[model samples]
Target: MTQTLRFLEDGLASDQIVALLDLHLREMHAWSPPCSVHAMSVERLRAPDVTFWSAWDSEHLAGCGALKHLDAVHGEVKSMRAHPDYRGKGVGKAILVHLLEQAKARGYSRLSLETGTSDEFAAPRGLYAAHGFEECGPFSDYEPDPFSYFMTRTL
Candidate 1:
């Protein structure tokens, strides 16, 4: 894949972007309720603290991810998705690495994420674990949610 990744704001309007979010929501709905709480609409993703990044194979959108600044030293991973056509093709890993690199560059000391605690979320949990995040209690404004698993990594 001849891929290029770029930072974007107001970027969720594209049909491909909408499709990716729909897939994410569909997958999450089948997860436990608490896990489902972490899902957000594209409108919510445009909040000021969030920075979104998207990966493209030329004109085709391959995947997208986002990071939200929780505080000076803390960041949260959000809205990670890989196109169905690109799953298992390293598109997610590449986007994740790029997001992590951006977090480090911004001097964040800890990176955190929330994912479903169900079979559907296994791959996402595994991906975060491979990147050095260890399971942890909820951070920031999150309350305990049975469907959710929180993980963190110190930069």
Candidate 2:
């Protein structure tokens, strides 16, 4: 599938984006003890520190992701989701690569992220691992949470 990834300044307003967030929350809540927080609402996603991106395939929203600035040389990945129809088609990886490049271009030397520690998050964790993110202690404002696994990569 041909996909195009782009930086989004105001991308959370779209219905597809809202649907993706909703799906992420639902899947997260299904985990034992519920791993992910019910954050990333449209309002929160539009915050100044957050830079969102959406992947499109012939006008269809295939996936989406975001990066939040933690400091001058660090960033955190957030709200990565691939549409159900596009899973296993490399949409997630493409979006991830795009985000990483954007982060590096912005002068970030490190990237960190928190994801669930449940089966539902296996694919995501694997993706990050393949991208050179090693399991790490919590960074930024996050605290130690059993349901969450933290990872980081130094660019």
Candidate 3:
């Protein structure tokens, strides 16, 4: 399905967006230990260093994701999730592509992210790998953890 992207200044102003974000966080908690979860809260996404976006299939919300400016030459991907109704519909890929474009536009030389290492995260891991995000050591403030899988790609 065709989707349009909308920039969210404060992350989620509408109730539909809010619901989607809530689901994203709940799933993160379910799949990863609290300390290992790097999903951003709405407030964090509102920070000056972060930019969030949502994909919409017409009036319906399809997915959401964010890019965080870690420094002059680096960016971090955060809070990527497809709405249940839109799973497997390319929403996540679209968001990831958008985040990469944004990172490049800002002149970031590298883009990195932390995802889960559990069996449940295999698909996401594959997605990142397919997009040229290879396994990497943690970037920014993140520390190594068994539950965390770090990936990075030169932008």
Taken over the whole model, the C-alpha lDDT of each candidate is 0.84, 0.83, 0.84
Off by over 4 Å in 2: 2-9, 32-39
Candidate 2 residue 54 Cα shift, in angstroms, is 1.0
Candidate 3: Cα lDDT at 22 = 80
Better of 1 and 3 by TM-score: 3
User: What lDDT does candidate 3 reach at residue 118?
Assistant: 98
Best by TM-score: 3
| Alpha carbon RMSD to native, model 2 | 1.8
Question: Could you tell me every candidate's TM-score relative to the true structure?
Answer: 0.91, 0.91, 0.93
Clashing pairs in 2: none
* Cα displacement (Å) at residue 34, model 3: 1.4
Lowest summed lDDT across 10 adjacent residues in model 2 is found at 2-11
**lDDT, residue 70, model 2:** 89
Q: Once superposed on the true structure, which residue ranges of model 3 sit more than 4 Å away at CA?
A: 3-11
Q: What is the lDDT of residue 152 in candidate 3?
A: 97
